[model samples]
Target chain A: MIELLLILCIVAAIIAIESKNLLSSIISLGGVGFSLAIIMLFLSAPDVAFVQILVEVVMLIILIRATINRDVTEVKCKREFFGMIFGMALVTVLLGILLMGIQTLPEFGTALVNASAESVPAKYYIENGLAQTGSANIVTGVLLDYRAYDTLGEATVLFTAIIGAIAILRKKKTNE
Target chain B: MNILPLFVTIPLAGAFVVSLFDFIKDEKKKNISTNIFASLAGLVLLVISIKVIGSAGVYSMGKWKLPEGIVLVLDPFSGPILLITNLISFICILFSFDYMSGYNGREKYYSLFFLMVAGMNGLVLTGDIFNLYVFLEIASVASYALVGFGTMREEIEATFKYMVLSSVATAFMLLGVAFIYGFTFNLNMVSVAKALGSMEAPVGVYVALGLFIIGFSIKSALIPFHAWLPDAHPSAPAPISAMLSSVVIKTVGMYSLIRICYVVFGMNTGQVPEVLRVLGILSMMLGVLLALGQWDFKRLLAYHSVSQMGYIALGFGLGTPLGVIGGIYHLLNHSVFKSLLFLNSGAVYYRTGTRDLKEMGGLGKKMPVTGATSMIASMSIAGIPPFNGFWSKLIIIMACIKSSHPWLAFWAVLGSILTLASFLKVQRYGFLGKVKDSLRNVKEAPFMMQVSMITLALLCLAMGGLMLPGLYDLIFVPAAGIILDQAQYLKLVLGN
Candidate 1:
């Protein structure tokens, strides 16, 4: 039943994405995001659901504002609608195939639960990372202690993007 | 006095100062204040990056213990990127000193610039996935605003398009992180990798990886997702064109992709590189093919940015040591030459007031320095020997052939030839042709611009020496080593 809802939600999202009015399209996109968050919650993954909510809200607000201010015209061509339908059908078929393939997957949960439940270091650190890293957060411990270098590189990339944006966006004014 | 926090704090402080200047009544006072803050702050970042490189170790934020609180990870991999960030940032700031003189709201521009740097530095240093997202958004949002800074028709339109595409990419990334966090009950990349190591791969894990690939691919402007580059890159100023084409796409898009795909998720089941190879070949062929017909100089360069990035992807995608080395070498070379080329175009615009090569001619005699430096950049990009681009391109081609993918090498070589042909068109029309009657008296760019261009051009020559034994070990080898060892990363976190 839950799977069915997810399929329906995705179908609705595709429709929302295809909506001619920019406002409705954005709204539908938000609806899709919200429903996905709900589906994640039902799957007992509250953390994923929470992040989904945050993302959904942010995306909806930004896209709505942008589209309202956009220079949109009528979707006057039937070919575009045909292209959209063809694309959607292709996606649906691909996803259906993937869902069918999932039956072949092994029982990952039991295996992980058994393997990690035994003597993995993760069991110790999840409970005691704060004491080990001197930071109050376990998440911090993992990012900084175990893989600080990756984080560092990621940050530099962000810095580079900012510089790029600033350089690209610098403006010139003229007296009218 | 701890250096890790200073990386974030200084830029944050710089942003504040820029904003403070914006509140000032006098325009001249505001401009001077912003420039002084930006320049000094950039110099400080440069010095600090050098110092951080010298003393290589991870520093947990707020004296937090491992896996607790926020942590700032510093290592050899990050060392060169820090230097790259600070160095290019300082140069871009210097370029802005003269370039932005004609623009409005100098303080706002400076403020956003510093904030973006701060966000990026924080993102690179933070080890947690969620923190990375926050920092990514900080940088992304600032970029969106900056892209629309001009408020001109094209600039505003480009900004909107870039914002939408980027927001979707970010959403996908956040969703990926969310899935990972749910699967592992943790947001730290190392912890997640550790969890992933001992367990059978879950369906959710595959989903998360798929999301990351799509997210970062879009951000990195990989071929299919490259709609925003030409419009966005050329919409901004010349220095920005350099920043966007050279570093932004690599750092934001490619760097994150590497971190998540290689370090965090522990390789793509051996299929990820294959996917990258296909995309690389597509981008290489299509980007240049599209560029061949362009008349705008910067627009042409933007298309080539996509093409050059394809080379980097191809190298890394080969998944061999030689390929990885070649990919990274190409990355460094591309950054230097691409930025120099953009700056050269900016200089051309500064004097001639046009970006169309067709309207330009024979002012090479008048602007000897710009002319000479642009030629060096052009040759380097076109894969001429003795310049940096040649060595890296050769390595990538050889790695492909060595790996028995002669077809990939053929495509890379073909792309190089096309790149040369297009750039020659630039040379013929923009610099080497008959001097336009209207542009006869145009002057060279200001001293600072000239200095930055010449320095970068010289670096182009020097970078070829990096393929030398000791030099390779010093820089590219360590970086490549980081990617090659997936288990070491697992041990680093679990060991901690």
Candidate 2:
């Protein structure tokens, strides 16, 4: 049943992406994101759902702000629309098959559980996540405690990006 | 406290310091002072990164214990990337000293530049997925602002498009992480990898991979998701063009993709490599095809960045030892040469004030340093003998043939020739032609810029030496070992 809903959402998204008006297209994209978030929720991932909602909201705000002064129907050619639809369908079909294939796998998340259950380090997080990290959130604990180097790299990427943006966009003086 | 956190803090601090100086009345003094400070700070960072690499371990922030607090694993893998991040940043800062004089507000530029470095370093070191999301945003948001830094129509347009796509991609990744966390009831990668590894694979896991692939692909600007790059990369200042092409996309986009695939999900996911391979092929062909027609020198180089990245992806996608080694080696090689190419373009722009190939004529007679360096880079990128690019590309093609994928080998060589053809166009139109009278007075770029280009160009020459037995052990082997020892990674992270 949920698979059917996912298909519908994806199809609708494809349609929305083809909308002549940019505003409508953006809205349709939001719809697709909303449905994907719903699917995530159905998969028992409330945390993911919440974050997706936050992201979707932020995206809408940014897009609307960015496009408000511009024409909604500036330059949407039929060929481009067709190409976009073709691309979306290709993605949808590919993902559908991949998802089905994933469903057939026997030891998806189970391997982590079995391995961690026996592993001593896994027992450490299981018992003392909060005690070690001083954070009640296990997610935060795991992020901060066991894999902080990855976090550092991730943060540095952001920092570099901000700098790169400033360097690229800064205005010039009118001396000439 | 281990000094890993300082890698991020100093840059953030630098950004604020530079921004604060922007309001100063005398912009010239401000510029000079800021340049000096940024360069000094970059040197310090270079030293510090070397130190961290020498003595590596898991650094839990604020003395927090593992699993309870944020941790930073500073091992060999993090070492080289961190080293590259700092080294490239220092060179860029040095290059910017003269190049940025054309633009205004030097202090702000230096600060933001350092901030971007800091973000990349933090991203490379961080352990948790959510933190990864935050740092990804830091790098991405900063890059968006940088893409629009020019504020011209094309620049702003590209930045907006990049920003929207990237933001949406980040949303998907965050959503994926949230799902992983809620489902696994854990957040640490080792824990999550362990948890996900143990559970009967759910529908959500595939969704997570989808989210990650889309996000990282967009970040990397792979073919289908690559509309923003050609526009954005060229629109930035030349040094920034080099930085973006060489480091930003690779570190944020490719690195994240590989780390997630190998570490979080494990390479056992049957379809993931196939997906990567398909994307790799698409990017390889499409990026080169699109680049062939471009008249803009920088834009052409930008597209080639995508193509070279494709070569890297294709090798890794092959999923063999030789393939992985070739991929990583090409990755390092590509970063060096591509940055050199971009810097070479920057030198031309500094002299000619234009990126259009048609407008440039006979630059070789005037700018000897730049012309020679560009030729070296063009040869390196085209897989000419004795350069680092040749060896890596040869390895990738050989790996393909060894894997019974001769067609891929054919495509790889075809791509290299195509790359050479386009760069030949750059040399012909932009550098080797009759010297345009208007640019006759144009001189070489400032000394520092020349020095940076020369250093990279020389590296292009010496990189082939990396294949020698002694050099390979120090650098390539350990990195390759990381990819080869997938099970060992899982064990180290999740085991006794």
Tell me the TM-score of each prediction against the true structure.
0.83, 0.81
Candidate 2 lDDT over A1-176, as tens digits, reads 57887897978787776577777778888888898889888876687789899999988998887887875555455576787789889879866855664454444446345434333445566577777668786666656556554555555554455455555545563132
lDDT of 2 at B478: 64
Predict model 1's lDDT versus the native. 0.78
Q: What is the interface RMSD of each candidate, in Å?
A: 7.6, 6.1
lDDT of model 2 at residue B439?
A: 89
Q: After superposition, how far is residue B230 of candidate 1 from its true place, in Å?
A: 1.0
Question: Across residues B1-496, which tens digit of lDDT does each residue of candidate 2 receive?
Answer: 2688888777777776776777677978888888888988899898888787634566666664545346666655667778877878888888988888877767756766766787688778877677667777777766777666666788778888878888878887886786676467566667677777788877767777888888899889888899888988998878788889998998899888887777678863368767877888889988998999999898899999889889988888887778877887888888889989898888888877888889898898899999999999999999999999999999999999999999999999999999889889989988897998888899988899999999999989888987898867777666666665666565544345
Q: Assign candidate 1 its CAPRI class.
A: incorrect
* CA lDDT scores, all candidates in order: 0.78, 0.78
TM-score of chain A of each: 0.64, 0.67
